[model samples]
Target chain A: MNNVYLYNDSFNELISLIFYLLKNNIKPTNIKDVSYNPNLFEECIFLGIKSKEQDINNIALQFGYYAFRCIYYVYLSNNESKELIIYYFILNAIKYRKKITYMRNLKCVHETLRIAEYVSHETHKMKGFTRFKEINNNILYAEIEPVNNILELVSKHFEKRLKNEYWIIKDVQRRLFSVYDKKNFYIIPEENLKLEDFRISKEEKEIKEMWQLFYKTIGIKERKNDRCRMNFMPKRYWKYLIEMEDEL
Target chain B: MELKEKLKILADSAKYDASCSSSGSNRTSKNGLGNTAIAGICHSFASDGRCISLLKILMTNCCIFDCKYCLNRKSNNIKRAIFTPEEICEITINFYRRNYIEGLFLSSGIIKSPDYTMELMIKTITLLRNKYHFGGYIHAKAIPGASEILLRKLGSLVDRLSANIELPTENGLKLLAPNKDSNKVDKIMSYVKEKQNRKFVPAGQSTQMIIGATKESDLDIMSKSSSMYDNYKLKRVFYSAYIPINKDNLLPTLEKPPLVRENRLYQADWLLRYYNFKVNDLLNENNPNFNILVDPKTDWALRNIELFPKEINKCSYYDLLKIPGIGVKSAQRILKARRNFTITFDELKKLGVVLKRAKYFITCNGKYFMSSSYFKKEFIEANIVLEDKSIENTKIEQLGLFNE
Candidate 1:
């Protein structure tokens, strides 16, 4: 009989499921996200892992801090099998120590690195591409639609740069917003925000127009290479770029 | 003039300069308006394909001297605009807050005097850093003949500073930019280098060199770059392909930018910094110019065939980096992965080594990827991937690879 583990999209739930399966000595046929509702009644074990640093460090210890970060980041990716990959990677790392990360040829390690890279790339791009417009001359508001759930990753970056300002970064695709006040930042996950909340200022519109003109003037006529530009700043990202709006 | 009109004019005036780097500074403050990353951030790409990393512009396009190659020269007849210190500071803070720029690249013409231009720039940065509480990366150009005191004060405020070399040779300097002295530019660069405190100009100093304009050979440029790196410890030496903007007897009559030569110089520059290569390794007295067909590293590997077919698994980290397709990341991966197990050709590809180019130079456990004799240069040259052939027109590709 195959033992199936079900989890919510919480890091704690995934950790608890791993421990539960190990303790029961049950071979998991599949460990699936409960949000997806992959299974109805296949010997599912619903787990509630109260996340402790010691428990996480127990699983993440062998490969050091970097390996733990990769596990955290990759777990947040849109990859369906990300949870399974993390489990196998951690299991291997527990036996092998930090050398498991260098073993890229292994399927689990390869997928783990790929997912981490994918998420980090999106986070880095959002750091630059996320354009904020002053709404009502009081608060700054911006929107993005990243492939990965990277709002949590990019929030700390903005928190450092715009510490004194009140701002909101809306992940439009996921319908989540990372809201930061003058003091600190927190996330409001779900369809709680509305367009009416932000009223664009006339000065913000003027500055954006002026910026677009500067972008237009900054390029050289003789060295016009659209293919080269598209490679670095891909077409998917064009929707987020303010300068790209007028060109379309 | 309106803000839109001034932005257009000033940005147009500044586009000729190729340095848009905002890298090599790790700045943070408790409640500052901005912080800088170690690798820097590129805000956007202009239609011309250059990175819009910083709000690259001149404080004023109006100048006292007429440098023949310059668009903003005194005699160019272009519409000139001078931005006030207040305007510069306001825009820097606003744009930075909007995520439009990582910082600002402030270069100016010698309006009235060197000290005068430098002082205004220093004032702009001072207000932005202290008053606005902005902590973004600031790269400023040091006015060549500015007072040392002004340069020191300017250095303390910005993350990086530069003094453009303008031309490679002394004669080229005299012929085109007569008002400027190359030695004086060096004086400012040396001054930037001499800063004992790491906090001041923490990203270090860099300079720009205009190539293919005058009668200077490739050897002249490389030799000059070699010495500049040794003497001044420049963070970077930018090679701008001489774009023909004016009809001058002194300037070369080229319809297009010499991007190929510029690209080669950059590749050679990489070898100097990362790959443990000297300018002499890239070019000697007789072989002054580089091979137009292949990249500089590949070209060197083809000529020095005896060093070929190194065992990738057994080779040192430095030797692995010497291979064209094996970059720093791939080399490090190979080192780490090999410690666990013997790396295979398929595994090398998985590790991000470009096997197409690397196959000629590397081996795996006494097995070569392809059967190609190293005795013949043309055989190796023809067999190796012509990476540059596909990317001849787009200097923008270089921008993506080498941000700084």
Candidate 2:
């Protein structure tokens, strides 16, 4: 009879590498009964694969990090080719070792800075564009669906300015919220929840009234610069601003 | 008096102030009601499209000085309202508890005298801090003629302080805002700096200068900003592109102030802060203004093509920053990613570098590559045509992508 070893294809390469070092006398074991033994392998590999459908998604995260780092280097150098170079570098670095600090000495740092500058620039633009609405629970709830992963970036600015308050900034597209409680910051995934029915407090009503009054009072009757106002604060953001609610 | 009437009068008075930023300071709560988490927040927007993070209102709209440019100038016919220290504290606390505002940004029009107005503003902030225990950010305007002692007192209470320069040039100030002395404004800014250095204004000081109202060129504005940053240690020097609110003979009677020019100044300002560029580099004796077509960095790159194709692997961080489309974050990322691998042009595209603008300025491995020819004259012409075509097409496209 021929001795054959059966293992899950997902773990085949890792198991094959492990099997090469197994004791010669140990045999006759079912693959289903095989358990990962940290002591058996000289190097331990942890693979995070969810369901079959999520396997690609899990792998893509590692690739996304590589792509992000590559683009960042390209942007820093003001050089366009540094990105491609960084991509190959990431692939090679992953194969060689877990640490990639050696890549910093490779001359691509300049280009990565250029890319970081671009990302920060877009994040700044979105900071001005993001809008918040007052919900009934005394929570200043703002819902933004930015094209980029900018929730962490934008939330930092708001958290500083609104220091003494409790607020929840929800990125509806990403299904995540940065909840602040005057002391600490928590980023949590919001389950399937509809925010439309959230209520506002009585205190909020009086404050909104005061805010609307203040907005109306500030503009000079004789010197209304609709063009300049529109130029800085566009009509698209009016829907979320308290004063523009009537127009919306 | 009715709260509504007072709010209208005070808010109307503050409309001219262009510094709407709610950033920089990070104040948190221990057992108090509020916190400043380092990330700023915007509660709402106004009719003029400015963010309303705080209930940014004046303590009073009544003025003693007859500055010709201000809507609240003593001679101007407008309704006046004054909020007492108690009134301000009440409003700030109420609005803050309800999450209507992040904090208070209190400015005033000299009600009786400069000392009197400064004292009132200071008292309001002190009450909010000591009595009310309000820990939220407060940005107060430093009255130009106020004493150093009072300025220091107010600076300690508020998170940020600003004294409006009002005009870029001394001659401009003399002509438009007659009551304001340019030297006095400078003295107040210097005092703010002296105190800030001595640990008075911890969040730093900011100032606003009106553009286009006076005959100060872009060169004059950049020079003033550069000097302000160097001498005063100002956090920011805001540019409020002058819009002719009142038809004064001294002010320019244009249909609109140059919004694009104001935008360009901000771009140039960012370059000064983050890119290690100087005011002289942005504008020289011949070209005293930023180019209207492209951004300042791009304009600089096109004129000084000798600096182009900087070797990605060999250039220092400072040299890399000079390239068009490359900014502070991208520079830092490149420095981090270049360690483990050799970077190529295709990878840079994925990193979000503006290839269109950067391709002309950088090279990898002694090789220059771009989608089009690297010749300056042809590239500019092609880019202009492409931009013009895109602008024409965008007019017909629906703008729902930006809608909330």
TM-score of chain B of each: 0.94, 0.92
lDDT of each: 0.84, 0.68
Q: Best-fitting candidate, measured by TM-score?
A: 1
Q: Compute the lDDT of residue A176 as modeled in candidate 2.
A: 90
True contacts kept of each: 0.76, 0.33
Off by over 4 Å in 1: A1-4, A22-25, A39-52, A193-197, B371-376, B385-404
For all candidates, state DockQ relative to the true structure: 0.66, 0.20
TM-score per candidate, chains pooled: 0.95, 0.72
lDDT of 2 by residue, B38-135 (tens): 55766555555556677788999998887767888888888888888998899888767545677888999997778989999988898899888888
Q: In model 2, where do residues sit more than 4 Å from their true spots?
A: A1-203, A215-244, B44-50, B197-199, B371-373, B381-389, B392-404
Task: Tell me the number of clashing residue pairs for each predicted model.
Answer: 0, 74
List model 1 lDDT by residue over A104-195, tens digit each.
Answer: 88888888988998899888888888899899666888889899999988889898888888898988888899999777888887666555
Interface Cα RMSD per model, in Å?
2.3, 6.4
lDDT of 2 at A82: 35
Instruction: State the lDDT of candidate 2 residue by residue for A173-242, as single tens digits.
Output: 7799888887666777887444567786555667777766776766544444454466555565455566
